[model samples]
Target: MTEIQDRPAAPLATATFESLSPITGDVVGIHPVHTAEEVEAAVARARDAATWWAGLSYDARATHLSTWKGVITRRLAQLADLMHQETGKPHGDAMLEAALAIDHLAWAGGHAEKVLKRRRVPSGLLMANQAASVEYRPLGVVGVIGPWNYPVFTPMGSIGYALAAGNAVVFKPSEYTPGVGEWLARTFQETVGRPVLQVVTGFGDTGAALCRAGVDKVAFTGSTATGKRVMAACAENLVPVIIEAGGKDAVIVDADADLEAAADATLWGACSNAGQTCAGVERVYVHDRVYDQFMSVLTEKARDLHADASPGSQMGPITMPRQMDVIRSHIQDALDRGGRAVVGGLDAVGERFVQPTILVDVPEDSLAVQEETFGPTVTVARVRDMEEAIARTNATRYGLGSTVFSKSRGMEIAERIRSGMTAINGIISFAAIPSLPFGGVGDSGFGRIHGPDGLREFTYAKAIARQRFKPAMALTSFGRTAKADQQLATIMTMLHGRGTTIPKD
Candidate 1:
């Protein structure tokens, strides 16, 4: 008999913790801290479920996903409550994040059939007698390790796309936000009537277990240092990985930019979610012409923002405790290097929450400029021109995402910046468009999680060719003629055999 995947309530408490509110340090909820063995079990079940799920046609998979999306949409408020309790983010922010995730889910489900279905290709005159086609096949099971920042929107970049591509998912959310992960899996099971998606909650070790649990691929969203470790762990099983790592992304404002819009976008990009975003704007480079105006607007906006554990606060506590130290160090480094804190100063970092901070005149080599602070801190630097802004923005090893605010040269300057997605006249808005690929290069990691790239990431390309007829002069058999050989040479000469551009002897 096939055993059902639903677990008994008795074993739920094997891992327990007090999820605290970042603002008040009070227990919000108690969640399970799953073990490595538990994570392996979840993967094992997901692997079994994937066999059944992947066997369905692309259209059938789409229908199943649509049903799941409906469930998510209807019960979004309930899910958002759990997100709020776990991460201490504002309820509205959680809802916005969930809404965006649902949008991606809907897009992924509706489009996966078209993107992944087999398609025919031209065989060329040389192979006219043969039929050729390419199709994408599922990789069975995918393991996802999520981050606490933007919990729903970020991991869904992998989870939704993977499900749409017809692969089962085993997710291990960050230790700081396990309840949200559990809620998602629970709702998925209730709606789909299967364990196509499952959660294994724990800290880093549990996540590591999921990587080595014989899954075909691992999609990780976290710091760059942790991303490297995740890649190394997956390497043990030869598992493919897509890492969405840390970013020191910058916003470049040209002399022709609308200073008001640029300042607003820059402030939100650096302060939203307490600047816990992976692709959030950490630095701003404005042309000297409007530097003063931008700075004034930014500080005024920063002053109005507040970080508290309260439900209505615009910002929340740093989800991870250790990150507070990193935030403090960045502020201290900026201060020690003669940078002036235009708004919140060194005391901005609290036990769990970090207040909005704006610094100016920081040296280019300071930690605040070079490293990812991952907090609500922005270093505003004045650039001589757009060229200097582009150069300074590209100087970071991390190139996850960026923003540009220029009237005429927006796209031109944006394309020059070394990042994955660039938002013009906005901030981090490209991630909402399902057609654009999301991921980064260099230290920010490779492989995408949304769009067609996301659908293809969970699948491998399969090519098929079949001979339809025998050629007049068979090239592979012993029936070839001299005339055919001469014709082939003529074809080669007409193509790649022409005189080299370098003039070959």
Candidate 2:
């Protein structure tokens, strides 16, 4: 999910629409263009379904989710094929995406009890007469608007966690992959025997409708521009939203790093899935000591990769036709600004697929550097030291994810980057780890949709403070006296008035 997905179709009402294959321009699937009324109906049904679903114990819900996980695992190949037809990604990439999603679903189900369940907290001396505890309660229904790229994995980040948290979901998949959305929903219904998960297939109107459909929350993933619009719609109803939006992720390579490994990771991270990943590597900052050598290895590998309709090609066609213009414009902007293309340039932009492109010496303000290209393109810049590299890496307004390559300084460098997740000596490793929360800061959007944070994202905290005994000072009652107030002040002074120690990370 990133800046490269298809923008929403204009709000022209239609009965049905066809999902086309980007590789062949053939209709892959036809789905009804659901209306606002229809979307409301689905959410309404989800509201009822959520009540019953939430009533079950965490273990019972886990069992149901675990069963659904098995079903998806069994039909992994089938789902992969549907994804390939709709998103034009390689079958292997699709399979990997779905497989990771399954892992997350399993983790969400198996761990929700521990992460979201009620747990006791120590009552301070001031409140010693009470037994205090806190738990996360499910928001009735969550509206999930997913992106076309990595359709299965991205949406499930929200859908799976929300369900595991005991909320029903109304998923509105990208208009480019309605079939995939329906398939997920249909399979869940077959196993759960209810509307715990439902799909509403349509264009942007349907998504806007979901925000206003009185759902407890909405989770959105797309371009930053689209995210703002989604937030506005959700705000109309004062609904909470988790937006996993666009990113211009970067990678920093130090002189002490493994050059060959960094080259491979950079090329793969930049070109894989046609570079539509929200967390995909778009900018590279290498220590000048190893910049030339690193470029030699990176370009050599980039040359071996090409975007075609080959059944087994690791690089596939651009999923959205409209996005081609943005890709071309970014490339042209860098070139016009005096950046030299080392591997590919304007010629690499094709009708459907884009060849892996590497540009060097691009200005920091160039579109290819400042914006999310959402294409198989990368910009390389040489820096004098790790200090310069870190500064440049953190310069972008978008910080969804980042990578740092340094044998001794990997962890240190990773900690300094302004990204939600940083992979040190690895490529997007945080995504595969279900316990790590995945999201971004600044313009990359807010909130999270993975791990414990993800499970709580669709829930409201419920704090319970039961009275165990009468307090010496009745602060809440009118009977509270001046003497009691003095005692409270004295207790506060003793407990918190002095200097305190901050715990170390």
Q: Model 2 over residues 1-505: C-alpha lDDT tens digits? A: 4431255564565688899998999999888888889999998999999999999999999999999999999999999999999999999999999999999999999999999999999887777899999999999999999989989999999999999999999999988989999999999998999999999987888788889999999999998988998899989989988988889999999999999999999998999999989999999999999999999999999999888987768899999887789999999999999999999899999999999999998999999999999989999999999999999998989989999999999999999999999999999999999999999999999999899999999899999999998988889999999999999899878767885943232
Question: Which lDDT tens digits does candidate 1 get at residues 1-505?
Answer: 0001112222444567555665566687676767777788888888889999998887888888888788989998998887887777888889999999999999999899789889998887678898999988889999998888877898899999999898999988776677788888888898778789999875666777888888999998887778888888999979999988889999999989888888889888898888888888899999999898888887887889889765578887776666788899999999998999989988888888888899999999999999988899999999999999999999989899999999999999988999988999888999999988999998899999889998999999999999899865577867788888998888767756756634231
lDDT of each: 0.85, 0.92
Stretches > 4 Å off in candidate 2 = 1-13, 500-505
Model 1: CA > 4 A from native: 1-15, 477-486, 499-505
Model 2 score (lDDT): 0.92
What is the clash tally of candidate 2?
Answer: 0
Please name the candidate that would achieve the greatest TM-score relative to the true structure. Answer: 2
TM-score of each: 0.93, 0.97
Instruction: Give the candidate number with the greatest lDDT.
Output: 2
